[model samples]
Target: MARLGAGGMGEVFLARTASGRPLALKTVHRDLSREPGFAERFAREIRTNDRVRSPWTVSVVDFSPPDTAPQWLATEYVAAPSLADWVHRHGPLPEPAVRCLARELSAALVSVRAAGVVHRDIKPGNVLLGAERPYLIDFGIARAVRDPRRTRTGTVMGTPGYLAPEQATGAVAAAPADVFSLAAVLVYAATGRSPFVARGEEPDLPALLYRIVHDEPLLDGVPDALLPLVGECLAKNPEQRPTAEEVRARLETAGEQEWHRVVPPALVAAAGSREAELRGLLAAAQPPVYAPVAAPPAPLTPPVPPATAPGTPRPAEDLVAAPSRTRKAVLAALAVALVAFVIVMIVPFGGGDGDGDGDGDGKDGTAPAGTPAPSPSGQSPAVTSLPAAWVGTWTGLGPGTPDADGVARARTQDFAVTVTLHAGAVGDVMGAQVSNLKEIGTGRNLGCTEALELRQMRGNTAVLAAVTSHPTDRSAAIDCPRGNLYLVTMTEPDRLTLESEGAQSAGAPAFLTRGR
Candidate 1:
């Protein structure tokens, strides 16, 4: 009937069987199907899903043959928004709701374990807030408890911020890991933030992994009633963490009435409307046309921002109705690409040998790769100089509104940047900077100090590359994206605009004035 969502593996759609029963159909990406051993893994998930039969899980209805192109698996369609979606669009669930979520998800895990399965991936995005109870979906990375297949060393699977300490270190996840992840999800439900989250900053992949392995989770916001049980579930040692059965037993089961009281009436109404729309389309004389789903649409009305400590940054996505949790999940997936790029591209710019030059390689850095060269000289070519009009310290505050085609596309968060550009050549090093920037889509503030390298300059614009970026605060531990390009174009002698060409969540261009 419509596209449900997409992920790293493939696209999902709201499909139907001959009997008109709605199903969530996931089709493998053609490119992913070509990867070695992908088919086997997909088949394994199908087998795993078939083995577990629980009211808390979306039951698998049918699947494609292992040898088929674009292999697919169809499961019962869940009209409810995911726990991540609900928490993101609204706010953290109240204490009663968190308790109910914990109890139900624990039961879901228990069922999977009894079926000899280990759900390696269990996070907010995988949990749906059904009218009756939450439903655990997506077993793409699940493994049979005694399957005997070994994962490669140094290859970790599962989302960060919810990974068990062992899983963070690339150890195979077991039943205990699922429990740890469930606890993490419950933390997110009780509080608007991930347990491993750094104060006032968006969740960083590297930092979350490190904290999972070495640091205690920030449990300050978890409700008092669920604190002890959640703490035990998050135990660093897998053996010490309670089993799924134990976790289920500890929490009182929440009846349907309790669930109704906890879930937002509007969210349930929205889901009901969506189901009605699907059914209407199915009854029509013509089949409904399906298009690729863009970022899930924001709610019709803006939600109230969740309350936080005075200095803490609220999840900005809540400030206005914008793209939902899909944005966060997509950003989290960037860790895979970020790691690969760092190893290949950023390694050359590793922290320099104590001298002021920022290049890590012993040799004085050459001109940035694409710079137009001056006539060859025996000595190192003199560094180019920035045009007089382009040199200055420019500052701009993002109005939290995009100005493209004179239409507001996405509502961005408050973003502010102060750029100090010095007259220098394409590879000359600058001192450093630590800017606090809050971009749209990403839910938290970002503080990064970085070494700047002039990369290029066209007629009216000069390009600066963030060669080395380190987080300026403990709120986030990972370094900012290296080699990010900031495009500065001069609108007037003393005024300019800056647009980030790299980070997608960098938000709209910021118009700036001199000496602000």
Candidate 2:
């Protein structure tokens, strides 16, 4: 079996059926399979997916959920190049190709919606490119329409750049949410990048969310003929976006004559590339006897942004409502794709995993065949420079209004962190104490007064050196190991965000609200 892909929840591999037909198999890692109710959720996802019948979707073949230590699912093999890989290597799909993709994907949504399912995660990596019937894959996080059990625990789901506005807030996604994500996908197909994301960047969730909620999509280079339709689909209000049926109709009718475009040359070549790569791998390995295999943890799906430091009362998913630690366990499963997408781990066909990270083949500064194109602007943050956007205090909802027993808070608990730009040589610091902390971590929380040194920047993220502090009156010096090593832009000027590079608590890492 060749390793096909992996994410935070499980890994996928290519396996041959008893009849010698190739099947894509996914095995749930042991950790998630052990969580209570996981079996039920996985069971639900399969049940809904089985009902979706679209030429555009990979057909679900079979699954094993025997209440055992590990679980696996299989789908018909689709060995086409991924849209992410194609776009990463070649600039963007031609206009006619983009229109064709929209029409077929919209058709896929019809089948999904008819089955009462929502494909909550529909980014480019989940789409495959082929000469005939390019397929959509990875419905691992999909849910039945109005399925209340879906993510009720408040875990943030969906990719940052592709998520629908309501989905970004952790609300249950509906069919229209898929339309929103598909619009983002089309933008990437046309421009070789996310509508809201620049290349080589870790999306700032808060800003990306803001764009989904309030800003116009960045459809800069989209073909004029297709722009209006793509723009309408990207509207902030779900109700305002076109229905899947309408999207399909508009595309087919508008370009009735161009329907025979089949697949673009780049995409056809991409298919050839996958076959060659797979053959090379097969040649080096010995044929193995068939046997069941375990899969690695799927991509990293990060949890909801940590509560806005204390009192600011930022909106958060209703994760506090879940009655048990199962939410935490589920969070581990929800990494964006669900939350794994928050932290995003969707694996591209040739790219390592779906985070757009390369496989380290750039020793000579030449991007390998499947590597993402170099960023169009901005250098790595190694120079210790700060963007003007991150110069203020940001606020967010603090830990939920509870104590596991569902008790309420007194003053809403103020939780705010600030970034100050120092004059000359002092430089800027992800420094300063976030206000209002009755209790934070098991260790002594670092103060904002003791500045953590800014080290470098990676795309939209800023890296910082570990900070160590000694308490007054000759107290023990505390070293915050890997504490606050990076900062992500939540919202320019007012809200900046960071996920702990090392030290972290359950559902933390949110932003600046008020100016200090």
- lDDT against the true structure, each candidate: 0.60, 0.54
lDDT of 2 by residue, 1-516 (tens): 444445655555565432234556665556667777777677666655665666777666666634654566667766566777666667788887787777778777777777666788898878877557657776754331122212343545666678888887778788888988988898988888778766676655456666667777788888887899888988888899999888877776643433235567655665565555445434432322111112111221112223454553533333222322433443233222121111123532223334332222233212112222222221222324554444444455445212422111112223334445332212344544333232233233322333556655433445554364333213334222223344343333344555443222222335545555
Off by over 4 Å in 2: 140-153, 198-202, 254-262, 272-352, 355-516
Q: Clashing residue pairs, candidate 1?
A: none
Model 1, 334-445: lDDT tens digits are 3222221111000001121111222222322122222222211111212255665555676767655444221113244556666776767777765344566553455445
Candidate 2 worst ten-residue window by lDDT: 289-298
Q: Model 1: runs farther than 4 Å from truth?
A: 142-153, 253-257, 285-516
lDDT of 2: 0.54
The lDDT, on a scale of 0 to 1, for candidate 1 is 0.60
